[model samples]
Target chain A: MHPHDPEVTAAITALDLFAGLPASALDEVTARARVRTLGRGARMFDQGEPVERAHVLLSGAIRIAQAGSDGGQVVLRFIGPGEIFGSVAIFTDHLYPADGIAMVGSTEASWARADWLDLIERYPRIALNLITIVGRRLAELQDRVREMATQRAERRIANTLLRLARQAGRATGAGTEIGFPLRRKDIADISGTTLFTVSRTLNDWRRQGLIADDRRALTLVSMAGIGRIALG
Target chain B: MHPHDPEVTAAITALDLFAGLPASALDEVTARARVRTLGRGARMFDQGEPVERAHVLLSGAIRIAQAGSDGGQVVLRFIGPGEIFGSVAIFTDHLYPADGIAMVGSTEASWARADWLDLIERYPRIALNLITIVGRRLAELQDRVREMATQRAERRIANTLLRLARQAGRATGAGTEIGFPLRRKDIADISGTTLFTVSRTLNDWRRQGLIADDRRALTLVSMAGIGRIALG
Candidate 1:
């Protein structure tokens, strides 16, 4: 399919970024965007690279993370379909602040920075939407900062699971399972803990019958149980 | 002074928020803004409050923070003259996500949400500048998240002091002093460390002639010393 295929435009129109935009404006957006597909474990962009495009995920799971000086990775967030990423760096000094890695096979629509900037100027509503998008992310990061300062490892991990479940949880026969394949290391990075602590915590939660895990896919067997821990 | 005073217009023109706007547009901006004076210890806004207005700091020091469910506050950032604050929360669900408090007597120019939105539409440059401002803050938060996930408290504290110094440092006889009066608790909150840890770390730095503290004021005696610690 071509970049300007109606299917792509339909997909773009369905995204929150294009919410309330008229069809012609959507066409403008669709015309300028380029589609990028990534295999599992492939990175969309690395931190500190000059940002060329702003992206919106079309499908699959991608995790945004930052690497420490010690070579450890800290997951900033996970993105699924219709979510925006890499745009935040465009308004900055033009460098991606985090790495966007595909957790699973994924496809995204990307617009060159100049085109995106012109699009935002021509359609101020899109600019407003982008502002709201960045604002909410800032709020999330603020919450993480507060939790890291005040909460212990267990509570942070519980809250992290709860948050991921809410953001991308899928219902199953067992319970609400996190939609994406999540590893213990991702939880460690998100919760500011260690792999060992996450393993130990998951083991404890498993024994208590609060969760069911098969490899990466985890289902919260007892939302109430996890909620109690998160509240604590 | 009246809200439409030329002094206010000049200050508004000088702000990074209104960068690249023409004189008439600046006048329009000045006309819509209301001057607010906050005494020391007063809060500009609290978390979860409806965002009534967006603000630009005209003078004095302010600290932005968020309170966790445990009733602990984590300092998110510090603001000085010509810097923007409390604006990030405007575009999100209309609720402030953090608290902005005056550390000293402060004067600010605020525009009601309707007015600010109108200004952003009328002058897209302001909107662009706002994007850059929020983007930079987001990048800072991302770095803090990574540091919280990977660094020890001592290194985090060093980075915190370095950040504060860069944001609002005053070159004095001693060194580059943090422009605001910061207590140990605030430092702890900013660094994601405890007051005890901050106290111990400050003492260690002071003994090593890295910093000088008098009451609530802190002066970084050696930027090189702190930079080395922060890098670790």
Candidate 2:
């Protein structure tokens, strides 16, 4: 693997927020962060582990989850390329609150916590970028909370499918298919329901011609209907 | 009214993040921030209003809400003394997504947006502190979202009451009484339920000797029972 290749350099340079930073600042960030790779199903971090760095996804997908007291796991969120993870633990002075695991063939990432603190001290602009990033995530979480409170299970499922489709789906002539690897149980965790419920709901949607489910893949047959359901 | 008097000075100083700033920084922040006294029911800012500043609640309580499409309002959160509001709108580069109104007899607050940016430029420490603050709030929102998704209405009500009591309650011989000036509808909005549901569940708790409803007040008679319900 060309760990120090120019393509990686170009990708990092193209990030809008970091684009304006001087090469020296970027080098400082690069100096403190090390690139790592993980194979499919490999554990990236476990709940209650010491959180020393925040990971920025370079490629592939990661599932962030927390174990419930009832012997089940709850998926908090999914992190894809160009996104950051492990921040909540950094600020709270606690162990990582969730477990992160690779969900695809392979994944690559870079991380820095101590370096980030030093970088923020030297470049306040980075801190401002972080504030905006964290702030947007906060708004998204608030919207999700609102949805959970007000929407029915069917609507929530529809909305989840729409969101995932937008974030990680590949378009086909017939329908858009989500590319990220996921199981029915993972869908249930993310959608905040039971696997049985998720199966039943997917079956109902299939019968209604709203979606086509192939056990391992989901295709949206009627995006407009999903939107209507989400609104309802 | 001593709008910039010792009480306000002490409160602002305790923020720690702002305490070590240079005199010029403090002056800049103070110059742009206006102190306002809001009477009960007065709207601090409405949904879609341009967000110009972030408010620090000096005293009293404020409810932050959004108008639902169905002509109802959803209370997102409540801000008490020492807490900050308006960051969500400020960072998003969007108009206020929710409305903020005084929920008590009166509220005293100070706000500054432009000046705060200047302060961040002057003192990166303040930006770091602000990041920590925003991150903490994000964690709390995640917890609340998880609760809404997993918990039943009765448990939600119980947890909400317990949380409010801890935040802004007064102790009486009978029990801890939530002192915030909240209407039944406000509680319903905060708890993500209809007013009818809130009233019904509260009445059920009262009948079961789990809580005492004192019209504008609420007192927990069985904290253990409430904890059990919340944990379930």
Candidate 3:
């Protein structure tokens, strides 16, 4: 996408980070942005890479994950369209702790590190908006930690589905589909369980008609049922 | 504590959040601050309370935790001197999602919500610093989630103790002592395990001379051994 592309300008303006930024500021951001596209499964950035840019997802999704010492991986989050990531390192030390991989055809507008910091310094409101985003994510991660600590694997899985559905669900005849490819391993990572356990839980939920599960997508057939399980 | 308490003024001025603000702004902050003292185990704020203030821990520590559906609690972090909490609510809808309790006799300086927002608005550098604080915290929470998902209970506990030691430990003859009261329950909460399991792990570690564990404090006798465990 070109800097002057109308679509790019529109997306930048609509971002929560740009919610109240004046048109001149938004224009400057658009001017500084460099758009990059990724094919399905492309690596956006690798774990431990030097942080060079701040990314805003304009379309599609990316999975942020960390590899464990044992070669296992944990999915930190799935960045949907219009969300920001890869900026944390820019603000602190310049190292990406996790790998971000594009889950599908995706486009992101990123600013070189100097440019991003200069933008935030020039328009402090941008930094304020970022505080809100990071703060919210911190709160959500705390909830996830609590769920992993106190809830059973099945309940954790149920709650994870409920959360993702709330964030990315698309209404369909099947149910509220999560409109993204999610593997059993992804559920395992999010729920802090093993893939085998995740597979078993998914099978049980499918048998109970709590979810319409598949490799390509997951549909929550009974949110109330999931909520009941999540409550425990 | 008075608004002009030399120690309080010094602490606030040294905080990264208050960094680079003119003396006038700092003076304004000090004047508007309210100091509160909490005895050991006193709560700074209960979970679900209306978040109406931004807190700065001036002396002692605070434990940030959330109660789970099953009556279990997860200790999100131990905030020591110079750290900030309860400010996330200031930027959002202003509801505390978790409980913050004093881990010891603690003193905190807090700004009323409106006053704090006004200060940040007037001096955008304060807002910039808050973004850094929240951003760093988001990174830490992500690490915790990864540990819970991937590490065994023993490794998780080892990692937790190591982290606490690095953050709050005081060197002592017995070992590198964590200078605060930390019960097995705290370890259990931090490690996402049962108190029974934590006790057993402590006993095992004590037997191996890896730690000097007690009711009032814990001392690491073997940091390298514990590091090996955390590495797993």
Candidate 4:
């Protein structure tokens, strides 16, 4: 809650959007933040809610997802700490298009929409940073669209696992483990496949010594094996 | 291309990116534009090429597509008159991720990357307009991701047709005619289906009096029918 709280300040400074600013500018940004803490499995915001603030995750993970009226969901992205989310809607229509659900106990800082606009106008670097972030996403989504059209389920899942590993993986003695509670539903949603298929494929990979998992986190035991499958 | 050429001046002013600029500012933009014309089936740019210029379509149509190394292609978006393409890479990496291919005889105006940056920096409204455009595309792509995960092929095709019509439709007595030569291959690429599936589905819709088409264009015969399928 305090602007100068060392933990909050450190996290805020680590963000890519604030990368080049001097200490004074960082202080100005830190002062504008309103912090919120989310419990695991709780939503930070729901789809169709009125837009209010632009958020940056400080700690833990968030799944940006949308559910169709017909019941299935798509995981648009998984947000890690020191990353931005919930800002896109502010630039478009003033409504959230997806839910920001905390997959773990997470804390984030948000600036009111008016404040965000003002900051970007003053610190144009922030606007450029935001644009770069969105552009990267556009490219990734284009790749996903191609995979959906051409690749089978196994290849899609393999690609998803490899991508997730690159994004949030941490080194472990056994292998590189994805650093959060990645559920089967998330894997299914990201790969555009069924839950049953996700479970079965992961199990098969486990049996072949390609992966390792516990109740919460999964690790890639053989990145080469997954890469081969993804290539196919 | 003379900056004050009435045709070029009119076309540049009609663009949403230049929506709020004064005549003087529009002249500046027009002055920077280098015009190019494409023959039917010509490529404006190819995937992985160096990003040189940002383009705005003046007339005719272009399909932005990416081809996988494995030989399948995905149509990313169909560009209509006054639409922007090949600019996202300017904000991300300096390489194009898709090929900009003319679907018919086409004309476009482009600005060198440095000039485009100078313009946006000099005119912040242009920056905001660009953000709004990319934000809108992000929303559409999210909805598409959801549909890919949840909906069947027929629904996806219906949605694509409706979206295309809304983007580039011209009203005719028979219906709203898609304002370009939308090929069956384009439909297959956009809808994440096979050529056989797109042709079969279009034939089925034609027999049911849901749509009408000639050699070059498709027209919506009963928008309500297509809307019904899209809703599912």
Candidate 5:
């Protein structure tokens, strides 16, 4: 088996969903996964594309999004290392319901649906893992739904910042610096607000000494205060 | 095997994720499922309960919701017959993230975690189906996220009516009537808007001859126009 390949082994091992699988199952999974490198701004898949494989983020970032009829786009979620996307469409036998684009230079690992299905049949643990993964995603979406229904735009923005900080933040003297490379529009997309609103809110937060932004980096000044806003 | 018992079958079949399991597998499933009845406005599970069984809706409606710190509640989704809702916490190993309440008199089917895992082992098709079902829910959440980010309140209200009409609507000469028993607050909860906003939008639609609400039943007078508003 080519399971000795470092990249394949690394990718499978990194995925938290596959944590409990035996080494043998890991080898089997790696054998079926095909690794591909992507460049920034590359379209990984378009809306309505046939979903033949599930893509896992091994390195870098990918944005799952939808373009509306009004020429506007919405960013659904940003996938980072160890996360799997496209598994849903692969199982459903339908075209992808959304589009994915590379947010940075990235390496993605993918598995054919047939091969993955075969593995799921062979390993029930993987099935459980998948269920857990999907369940977590559903819970996250439910949270988002709640936020959209009840929370104000500024509070939603604060919650988004806090969530991102926890997921991809780096430590600095100022606070946890969210280091993900995101444009203001990308932030707007993630937070479910307009770019103008994002700009205005950020400016307001900066004036109030809650946050500071430098290029793609944002440093939180008061996580406690941000939490208060999110609770609103 | 008691397969003919609608309560048993309904709970077992509520999950599209568990479809295609053989009778023997289903019998095993039936052993673990508890049938229960709830009165209107009764809480099936609270927001912070320890989630042990995946609750399957048999008859009547359940609102999966999140309560705001300010004592407001946002209904995330309405659960109907042949649908599942409590699987999210099972997958995440977290406390119940939302409260589920019976919107009307209701019956439910529920299964323990051990039985759920056993079924996954015995029937691969069911596992795959669950994956697909969760995936579709994720896609729907993505759509909602988009609406919250870019769409205005008017458009959100329009899209919500279109969605509810599709979900619970019945045909009539006036138009497709959303027959589900709903309060203005429930509509507001589902549409992610304030009750005031929902009231104003409905009034506007009524005045413009686009919709008619007689008690709890909402009739669409102009679907095409509603679609235009939703698309914007």
Candidate 6:
């Protein structure tokens, strides 16, 4: 769709990079964007592909990951609505480092590389905002590295749950439910533990009444307990 | 020395963030910068300090690290000549996430926060360059996390040595010498192993003639062998 579409303008303006741009500039950006809607498990971009555009998720979620030579996949992060991904290519080498896959139904607004670079040049604040965003991501990634290096599997999983809860938790009758659709393997991959370990830990938590778990959702029955475990 | 000093101007212009600026702009940046020489083992800034300036290392090396509450220290990475450090604080919450310590006799050129922000406003390329730097850093940190999660101690240390060799390796008669003052504890910290493990591994490597080690220098005697271990 054309960037001039009202829907596109609203979405683009809401983005931190495009926020505060003049209406005319926003119109220009909107005019230069292409929007795509994808089904669950659809691949948005492949690792090592020349990154030709920057994407802003309009709705739903996207998983960014890298596949190892041994067929093991590491989930780098999950991008939710209003967050931009694949834009790192604009500032550095123009190649995607990981595969961007759609999680659930997703809508993405994309801008061509040249157009996005032009916008950044015309609006320096966009570049500044991007630096801030990238810096925060780096800091978070470093924290994950530290956790993986020093923390135990239990503490790692506990911290990961708390982090996910903070990002996508919803209050429910049972407890604070994690709003994301996460599988056992996702938790295992994220926490650097085996699937069996995650399963056994969750079973233990269920028995202890520390958490309520289902196939697709998890409820933190006792955040204090989880915090204690995370601290340990 | 004044900002117009040929030495300062030359150094400033060499930085990636200032690479393409006009001489007049370089002079302006130089005028706003303060150059300091730090002795070996000097502390540049502590983690959690309010970031007040951006620094560009002109000579020697700097080590950036974080200290744990339990007195464990993690060596994040080392910065060498012409690389910018301590600038991540400029874009985020203005707080340094790690301590910057001088590894050897080091000369750094620094700009106050306000002046650096003004410089970035006047030159958008600086912000773009920073994005590239931070993006690469995030990618490297992610690799560290993945390694810590999936790799064993031997493979992790091997990979760490390879990385450091790539970053700061100096060709010598014995082999490709890593040009940094790395202790056993430093390698252990970087590889998330213990000093005992690192020392044992080094002793094993020395016996196998796979690496040449000393108190202040480490030479890779066989990159092929190290690569094999790292691949495992």
Per-residue error for A78 in candidate 6, Å, reads 1.3
Cα deviation of A68 in candidate 1 (Å)?
3.0
DockQ winner, 3 or 6 = 3
| DockQ winner between candidates 2 and 6 | 6
Off by over 4 Å in 2: A1-3, A15-19, A70-72, A106-108, A169-179, A200-222, B1-3, B16-24, B68-73, B108-112, B169-179, B194-213, B219-225
lDDT tens digits, residues B1-232, model 6? 4456688778778888787788788778888889888899998898999999999888888888886443446788888788889898788878888899998888899999999999999988788888888888777776777777777899889989999998888888888899878888888988888999999999999999999987778999998998888887
What does the lDDT read for residue A155 in candidate 6?
Answer: 81
Candidate 5 Cα errors over 4 Å, as ranges: A1-4, A172-174, A203-212, B1-15, B69-72, B172-175, B204-212, B219-225
List each model's interface RMSD: 1.3, 2.3, 1.7, 1.2, 1.9, 1.8
Against the correct fold, how does model 3 do in TM-score?
0.95
Q: What's the lDDT of the predicted structure labeled candidate 1?
A: 0.88
Clashing pairs in 4: none
Please state the error at residue A107 of candidate 3 in Å: 0.7
Question: What lDDT score is found at residue A138 in candidate 3?
Answer: 82
- Give a tens-digit lDDT track for model 1, residues A24-85: 99888998889978899999998889999999998899999888666756889999888998
| Candidate 4: RMSD to truth | 1.6
* Worst window of 10 by summed lDDT in candidate 4 chain B: B1-10
Alpha-carbon lDDT of model 6: 0.83
Report how far off residue A215 is in candidate 4 (Å).
Answer: 1.6
DockQ (Cα-based) for each candidate: 0.74, 0.51, 0.69, 0.68, 0.64, 0.63
Alpha-carbon RMSD, each predicted model:
1.8, 3.2, 1.8, 1.6, 3.0, 2.3
Inter-residue clash pairs, candidate 2? none
How close to the true structure is residue B66 of candidate 4, measured as C-alpha lDDT? 93
The TM-score values for the models, in the order shown, are 0.95, 0.87, 0.95, 0.96, 0.90, 0.92
* Cα lDDT of model 5 by residue, B103-213, tens digit: 888888877877776666777777677787777777767777778777888898898888878766778899888756778888887888889999999999999999998
Count of backbone clashes for each model? 0, 0, 0, 0, 2, 2
Ranking by TM-score: 4, 1, 3, 6, 5, 2
lDDT of 5 by residue, A1-232 (tens): 1344796688677687677888888877887788888899998889888888878888788888887766567877778788888677776647887788888898788888788778878887787788888887777777777777677788888888988787777889998887567788888888887789999999998898898887867888889878888887
| Per-residue lDDT of candidate 4, residues B67-133 (tens digit) | 8777767999999999999998898999999999999999999999999989988877787788788
lDDT, candidate 2, residue B179? 71
- Candidate 1 lDDT, B1-232, residue by residue in tens: 5677777777888998888899889888998889988899899998889989999999888889877766857888888999988887778878877788999999999999999989898888888888888888888888899888888899989988988888889899999999888889889878888899999999999999999999968999999999999988
Instruction: For candidate 4, give the lDDT.
Output: 0.89
